[model samples]
Target: MPARRQAPVTSHIWASGGRHLWPSGEASALQSHERGHLVYAASGVLAVHTERGTSIVPANRIAWTPARFAHHHRAHGDTDMRIVFLAPSLARLVPAHPTVFLATDLAREVLLALTGPRNSDYDQSARSRLSRVLVGELREAQEQPLQLPEPHDDRLQALAQLLYENPGDNTSLAEHGRHIGASARTLSRLFHDELGMTFYEWRTQLRIYHALVLLAEGRDATQTAFACGWANPSHFIAAFTAIIGTTPGRYRTN
Candidate 1:
């Protein structure tokens, strides 16, 4: 028999859920708020970028960035972004680094209840109980590798920023390194040490990450493939599926 999908465990955690909306391609300025928060994309996809890495938060995913972690957010498609500030105690339940969590059904319902229309039905005590449950559920939730770690070396940083800005560029790492005044060997070493991945692997991850944004903007697979520097649609599909756990065709941004 096939395995059944488990329903999301319901609970609540946010001391305050501040809701906001973003049109496709809109992004917040790089920032560091005083409080930590859980960011949820109820209708679209979002990318949360910090010093550590970029976390992709799709409709099925939630992103948690700790307090004072300088970060920015970008929307894919038209996003209904929801935020819940965490108290220091509740924030402890999430990791210090940015992370992506699968949004389960129960969690979604709980989030809507807490953050959506005011619930006169639930008094302060009920809401508090719900918050604890939500936090606990998120704490135990499995994390996804929807994050792309950032590089630190000057040359590598240049390369990463270049790729991030123009993911469709077909420049090879060795070629990029040469233009940046570094040898392929040195660049490879930097990538492995600083970013913990090979040049090719890192580029693949970056391309796929960009592909998510493009696809979420409702771009077709072939167009997205070209945009992400994948010459072949079949190759692009395989890479996106391997990294994102889904085929690009079904990876809805809208």
Candidate 2:
């Protein structure tokens, strides 16, 4: 998510789960599993990119990827990623699509236990029980607004790429429309119909995504605010807190 760094992406796989240690910017190859799985960032942050959208997984959130959905993962900082694959029966309890969920204390503990290095210590019955508890915990947790939905239209895709490439770009939607050969009114309709949000709302989410990455990289709130196109740091803090459920400074500390 930030500048790419040279560090090996180390993965340890077992029967039902595994753990990965990735350096900042380390990314996994695009691939899909036969089973749905939950991914949690024990440290740092992970951006799970799929055709549907990108779900940002911070320490306080967990991401679910449905079976066979092509996706990849990128670390925003030195990240310890824990993953636990679910059997069809267990997966049915969660959403069928890729989603980010608020991680309660119980859910976090369950995730860590499922993917811990000594997971082998748990027998089959014990593992299955833990898996059930983990899924049950997540099933009740609230879905988070950490996902940035991707647009399908070619014009919208182009515009999205432009903003993605430079999140600090302050160009208005109308100006972006002209540059992409579409009228602002047309783009607005497409956004509402296809993406279910206004241009400004989508842009704000995109900026929040970038802000999370910047914060993960240890940047201060003020710096991350400006880097993500917020002219006023206070406004950025408010927007971030509203969506992320925590202020940037507190988020960093946590």
Candidate 3:
């Protein structure tokens, strides 16, 4: 007899069915499916990028991505990933794009159960009901704006990595350019070409993202502002409001 081919492990419409841990610099290729996806980081952080934006999902948070949206996912450092896929009909409650949110303990437990062995002989009605409930809870969950807009050039990419590593660095564009071996004008042009924003605007966006992370960790705005390289708290607040669509305090409350 001819050798039989094993079925592929990956499926389009299915539960998590397993817990996956990823090491630093690990990444998944760009993929799109008819079923929506929920990606949770159990221990460290995961970064997700879609056509809409880039989400920085830390532990205790989950990123919901709707069906048919091309995207890529990766772990920043050593991280744990729990992924669940929902059928198209069940996923309609969520927007047709990516949204990040805080995952409740109950939801977390249910997500964990998804990775367990399946009961092949049992009726699947109970499983379907549970999955429906999870989908509902996930849809009504608060939407968080913890995303950073990505720049589209090598220079800005390098600068972004530096800013992310040290949010407190208060270097001017000229100074940063010197460190990155580029002239101020060249850097500015690169920022405009890649990010569609000025160098200062891009820096402000980075600071705001850092501020959100700090604030989520229970830091006050004033402290976060200084920590994110803003000379004045007021300036930080203004920039945060401009890009984030609300005051820092209001944004954090959700």
Best by lDDT: 2
Model 2: residue 103 alpha-carbon error in angstroms: 0.2
lDDT of 2: 0.90
lDDT of 1 by residue, 1-254 (tens): 01122222223333476566777767776789777887888877788888887888877777888889998887777778888777777787778877888777777677767677674567878776776777777877788768788787899888887877787888887799888999989999998898888988888877877777777777899999988888889999998887776788877633
Q: TM-score, each model?
A: 0.84, 0.95, 0.60
Q: State candidate 2's TM-score.
A: 0.95
Q: In candidate 1, what residue range of length 10 has the lowest lDDT sum?
A: 1-10
Q: Global lDDT of each model? A: 0.77, 0.90, 0.70
Model 1 has an lDDT value of: 0.77
Q: How far off is residue 132 in model 3, in Å?
A: 1.6
Best by TM-score: 2
- The TM-score, computed over Cα atoms with residue i paired to residue i, of candidate 3 is 0.60
- Please provide, for model 2 over 148-188, each residue's C-alpha lDDT reduced to its tens digit, 9 standing for 90 to 100: 89899999999999998999999999999999999999999
